[model samples]
Target: MSWHSDDGSGTTADRTVEVWPDDDRLAEELGDALRDAELAERVAAAGRAALAAHRREAAERDDLALELFLLTLVHDSELAGGPVGVRDRSGSTSRTLVFEGDGVGVEVELQDGQVEGQLVPAQAGRVTVRRPDGDVAVVDTDEVGWFHLDARPHGPVRLVCESTRGTCVTEWLSW
Candidate 1:
């Protein structure tokens, strides 16, 4: 038994294959192969089911994200359009970004190779630093809603705040 098939580069390739010989073991081997194929199909179905469930969960999270406060960029001190923080002692061209909102306000200070922030209407919470690559860090706020990220923002970054009051996701900003 022999055959010819494409080698997957738009080129045809010669192939050689052998079929089972006619013998008492042939039937048993065929039955085993069939059973193995069935098992493979079952496993594939399970994988599909798991993928669907994961997608559904992601959709649910997106829906809930709608209720979250999307922190908008209201002020950027470097542009001289807003106020900058006075606590920047290391002064590595420190910049302040204020995201003002009706319910919760946020101020982010970038200085001395650190990212510091404070939430308005101070409350305890968790802030997740998210970057285009992936999650950078998740830092918990103090009782006064002050938090700092250990990871430095290299590129565009966003913050997801989950506090006692509510959840909010910030707009992506280039750091």
Candidate 2:
């Protein structure tokens, strides 16, 4: 269904479209609907671009967010933010992912060997990580823009984020 929400500026003209059931059939219908709605194609394209940009920004920001949160936990909680080295039912070890943000940090610990890290909203996406062995792993962020990479067993590994905006990388540390 097509919906709209105001920007809370006391003006209904300044509205944001909210589409539901983002499925293939819905998408096709939306594309057809856009043909009838005035400037709907531009609106949809702009909205998609904006959402893609936001996803890229989140991925770029995640390394810092993870680092800062991990630092806080390591100092305040006295917990090891490293790979626990034990495999779960999926045959992958759990890892605590700490990323730093501006004045605020986020920590996500998952028992899945790698954090599903970033959600890029672009079909054309890349996640480059410098492996502990000095090899690089470049992966597509998927259609929905989600990407995952296994953190190294030990030694210094760096996660590099690259997208239409630019590129950013994390610091080297033995995990």
Candidate 3:
């Protein structure tokens, strides 16, 4: 009369995560009335708010140290023959990019076709490089407002510096 056969070989069950009780904190907190879409929307909104707040706080700093840190990381690529001279085949060639503006001084070395440098500014947020190819690369300064640029050709190039207050661009440099 039972659902199982009297032979004692019915169906055995074991504790498995997929088939067992799972964490229901989110469900419990949101309640059964809230749909999945609503929960997702709420999470997205919260994330946006947090991102906005962080950006605002960064903008309110005395200087762009945080932005400079990011810039350093991106521009710290290794370039050969330094960033100033033509690419050489021997691999002993290297150059340096010197950025001087608004009482800030920064020196970066170019080797292995990469840029590795730093920022020595009282305050800096962003740094941008416009290569002769018309491609643009922008990097944020770190906590110390330091930055570097990747190794590129000696053609017409532009360097732009930016912060919460404003932006400044270098005229042009010959390779």
* Candidate topping lDDT: 1
lDDT, model 1: 0.81
Compared with the true structure, what per-residue lDDT tens digits does model 1 show for residues 1-175?
A: 8778987899987778767677767888867876797787997899999999999999999989676877787878877745544554554467788886558878888877688999887888888889888898999999989998767777888988887767887788887
lDDT of 3: 0.59
Number of clashes in model 2? 11
| Deviation of model 1 at 77, angstroms | 0.3
- Deviation from native of the Cα of residue 32 in model 1, angstroms: 19
How many residue pairs clash per model? Answer: 0, 11, 27
Instruction: Identify the runs in model 1 with alpha carbons over 4 angstroms from their true place.
Output: 1-55, 81-92
TM accuracy, model 2:
0.37
Q: Evaluate candidate 2 by giving its C-alpha RMSD to the native, one decimal.
A: 20.8
Instruction: Tell how far residue 79 is off in model 1, in angstroms.
Output: 1.7
* Winning candidate number (TM-score): 1
Residue lDDT tens for model 3, 20-93:
24468655655654557878789889999999999898787736543332222222223433454545587566
Instruction: Provide the lDDT at 131 for model 3.
Output: 73
lDDT of 2: 0.55
